[model samples]
Target: MTSPFDFDRELAELGAAHLLRRRRQVAPLVPPMDLQPDQEHLRGTTYLIDGQERLSFGSNDYLGLSQHPAVIAAAQQAAARYGVGATASPLVCGHSPAHESLEHELAALVGLPRALYFYAGYAANVGIVPALVGKGDAIFSDALNHACLIDGARLSRADIYVLPHRDLAALEAQLQASEAPRKLVITDAVFSMDGTVADVPALLALCERHDAWLLIDDAHGFGVLGAQGEGTLAHFGIVGQGGVAPEWQGRLGRLVYMATLGKAAGVSGAFVAGEPAVIEWIMQKARTYMFATGAPPMVAEALRAAVQLILAEPWRRQHLQALQRQLREGLQAAGVPWDLWPSDTAIQPLVIGRNESALKVMAALDRQGVWVPAIRPPTVPKGSARLRISLSAAHTGEHVARLVEALRQAA
Candidate 1:
């Protein structure tokens, strides 16, 4: 009998290209191991995924608030007070006192007049883009932006220009040549893949020259960077002042900031903060905002507590920074090639040119009880397969040392 499918050769070619995907299960009773159906064992960094113990370095819970007693307690209390679900879309009665209260707290934290929440970071990006720009508008984006940002720009129906990474000159040229009715420059404050920061001040200057609005998605930077953890804008000390870019001074009000709570905040959901008119416009126009259910009240409560912990417990950030410094310094001292180790942030990438090499390294580390994952194209550029090493506050210096030792042994 003839097969129904005809792409066997092409499929095999893809496998040969190291682009195939698969999964494994975590055994019951293994701490932090990911338990998936139909598998005996797999690696994981969190102990309670399906309820097990595993040493985790793969999670984005940079501040380690995911299991923080206070944060968990807050979530429990909120669920007890508000119930298991919000019941309906925020526009249709899901917006509760919990949501409102979190919004106020987040607004104050970011030094903005208002903030609007979304169920996920991707939804927030998609909603914000379409709400702000349309058929006659334009968006200048960084080339290595997160997938959500790329998708959001595509959904916006605006003329989108992807500028070279951190190339202000090229961006200015694009802005100079464009005559779209509205202009928006969007970027991830920290590139998730490479862990590099965006040049916000330079972008702000370029925006002023062309009367464009700037949107900084601080998904990775939000709860880990800046004084008081306000994010990249504050990290660079450019948010509150009005004189750095005189042409953009008062116009700084047009700088829109959006961030996810799932990373350093160790919670779920995202929000956007900006001028009253812009937010009001989104409330009235963004489909995700108007149609989707609000973030769960309990998640908001957890995030509120997470934010407080980030601010009150500055040691978490300090610890994370120190860990990064130690890891970088130790790796350098050990003669690990710097060219292979890119990223100053906790999201260190141990570049392995071949996907199989990266996966092999990951397997070797996993056998030693570490859990960094192999990232390959198309998630990254071709020939850039890497072990994406993410650090968390929950980890100790000893943990970092162990990973470094494992890398040395693997090498």
Candidate 2:
């Protein structure tokens, strides 16, 4: 029963290159016997990693809705009414009123006509791309697109042209030269690892000119961007008018909007929003949608509460901005040589360069009871390994300062 594949040696090679990823078990800090006033908020940003309490700069709970009492209560109530599991695929009787409501709210939140909910963001992309374009079609993706988009393009059987990151001119050049009958341009509304945002308005314009569909995965942008956390579209003053914005209104048909509920919304699923006809087509044809079991009703309900919080409370985003400024300023004052990317968003990347160096810095912080992970190659390009410091509204100013000091000490 000996396997032909040299798995051991292959793994050893990966380890040697410091490219092997290890998962650290992490969980909330159970409140102390003598608890503080805002223990729930403290719990969300602090974690017990490997039996030690640590300040976490690795979470995507950007607005801290994950710990909100309302969100948790909504899930509990829904569970009592509808039970825990969804039992079957959406096409086979798993879809519920909760799912429908979340979808509708999602559509309205993004200023699109309709929305289709998916159990996961990855499923949304892989399913949507293939449903939109196939063999004779072309997909022009950003060179720095998330893996889901890349996988989706591959699944579509389309000719994929990866344009240089943020290079609208190059994207336009390809669109102009392409002869494919159907074309799709896919990008992340916010580049995840680098913390940089896509110029979505420009990308949308290009897609419009080329007579193509623009699918933006706003996983990092949703619940974090915009004046009301309406997302990246609103961030650019282009989307979210309930279809009344004159300049971008006519072009809404060409835009396929998608965002995750997990990061900023503090829930566990994703949804695709667009024109009714287009979403209908995707819902009908996306294999991931057709076959996967629906997310539990509890999740849908919890997301509803999360959405309300995102709109009702503006302080989360404001505090997040303050934290961003604080971290950047602190790092600058410390004079760290590595570049802190020019990102005003919550995801801040400190490029450490080289796998060993990145891990070294990460380990140094771990020793200081800080839990910011080191990101290495394939996640980011080779030689650009970094510490992707994810800031959350749950994080305090003190926490940011502690991280800055830890990083400084490590440096």
User: Number of backbone collisions per candidate, in order?
Assistant: 12, 0
lDDT of 2 at 231: 90
Lowest-sum lDDT 10-residue window in model 1: 40-49
Highest lDDT scorer? 2
Q: TM-score of the candidate numbered 1?
A: 0.90
For candidate 2, lDDT tens digit of each residue in 66-139? 87778988999999999998888888989999999988888888888899999999999989999999999999
Q: Estimate each model's TM-score.
A: 0.90, 0.97
Residue-level error in angstroms, candidate 2, position 294: 0.8
Query: Which parts of model 2 have CA positions greater than 4 angstroms off?
Result: 1-4, 31-41, 241-244
Off by over 4 Å in 1: 1-13, 23-54, 240-249, 337-342
Whole-model lDDT, model 1: 0.81
Estimate, for each residue in 1-411, the C-alpha lDDT of model 1 and write its tens digit.
Answer: 647685787778778987887764433243222335532222223443223345556778888777676887899999999987888888899998988988898887876778988889998898899988998899999988888889889999899899899889999999999999899999999988789999888888888878999998999998888767777777787653232233334666768889999998988999999888988898888888888777779988988899899889889888889999988887887776424456767687778888888888887777776767788988898998888889988778877898888888777
Q: State the C-alpha lDDT per candidate.
A: 0.81, 0.90
